[model samples]
Target: MDKIIKTSKTIRAILKVLFWVVAVVSVVILAAILVALFMKGGTALDGGFSITLGNYSLLLNQEYSSQQLTSLHFMTFANVALFGTLSCYIIRVLLNVFEPMSQGKPFSTTISVALKKLAYAILIMGIINLVLQIATNLIFYNVFDIPSLFNADRVESCSISIVSDGSFIIWFFILRLVGHIFKYGETLQQLSDETL
Candidate 1:
């Protein structure tokens, strides 16, 4: 019993550190993206509060049509897909992270910790992406005096403002639900250990 308790605490501490490390990496990656955007798009990119704030004619019109897109539209679509793929990949890792944690095995605790943190980091970034999307869209519509190509009513809605707000909430909440389940699974593991 004493050995088990000690092992659990040690593992938990290691996992906590692993979580922070992955979170740090995620932040760094996100910062790198912002830096790249600034480097390429320039300081005007910083003047936000509107989607149309910048080159609305250029970015929005460039949407991926049946024909291949040429410039920023293609880039924008690719970015969305890239983020989605990354999120799915991270979610897969998170699912695996549960196995070791559920079994309370020390064998892959380190890997599990890393994956869990990575999943969290990716999920947070996804959420942030959604927020920025919605915000820029709002600024585009309201401030910049351009229409949202996505949806008129949806964009016009007052309540849901986050780039990923409203419908995105419904969609991503499913992922959030999975996260909560994983969280509860961890809690249950702790509880069972106490029971034992």
Candidate 2:
């Protein structure tokens, strides 16, 4: 039990650090995008291997009109911010679930509730990501006149893909099953206590 508690605490600490890092990076990206938009001359985001503190890079290389580039940057920043926030929320939920386990109360109702909430949060985040990706792709295709390589028939083949996380869904079901098992165990424990 002590070992489990130690591990849980370590994982929670790591997750907290990751959450803050992501949040800070997202904010920096957002600020950079806004600054670029405000400037009359557009800034280019080149990709290269370098060890710099605040330097950021995007996949796009070609020069774009100021308006188009601003729009693209805004969309990309929004996507990053949205996903980062969702990730932080999921991490926080997991930390909550782990807290009970660290205290040797792994089968508590709080853990079950946290797990259920985490599952739902993941589902919602996936759906939102799909929608955002499709929309952003459509915007890029139309704005940049980038023809779709996959489908030649369509002028703008902005394909919508469902980001399927099979493992996440599996975990959801597993958590639900475990929740039931915990409830049963609690019932048995209660009965045993009464008899004693």
Q: Indicate which candidate wins on lDDT.
A: 2
lDDT of 1 by residue, 12-83 (tens): 566556655655665566555554444432232333222333355334323222222123333444455456
lDDT of 2 by residue, 1-196 (tens): 8898888888888888987887898788878878777778553543332222237533444555566567777788788878878888888888898887778766666776787778788777767776777778777667655452235764544433445455656766776777677677767766876899
Name the runs in model 2 displaced over 4 angstroms. 43-62, 148-175, 182-196
Most TM-score-accurate candidate: 2
- Measured against the true structure, the TM-scores of the candidates, in listed sequence, are 0.31, 0.73
Could you tell me the lDDT of residue 40 within candidate 2?
80
Model 1 clash pairs are: 50-139, 51-139, 51-140, 52-140, 130-164, 133-163, 134-163
Give per-residue lDDT, candidate 1, residue 28: 63
Model 1 worst lDDT run, 10 consecutive residues: 61-70
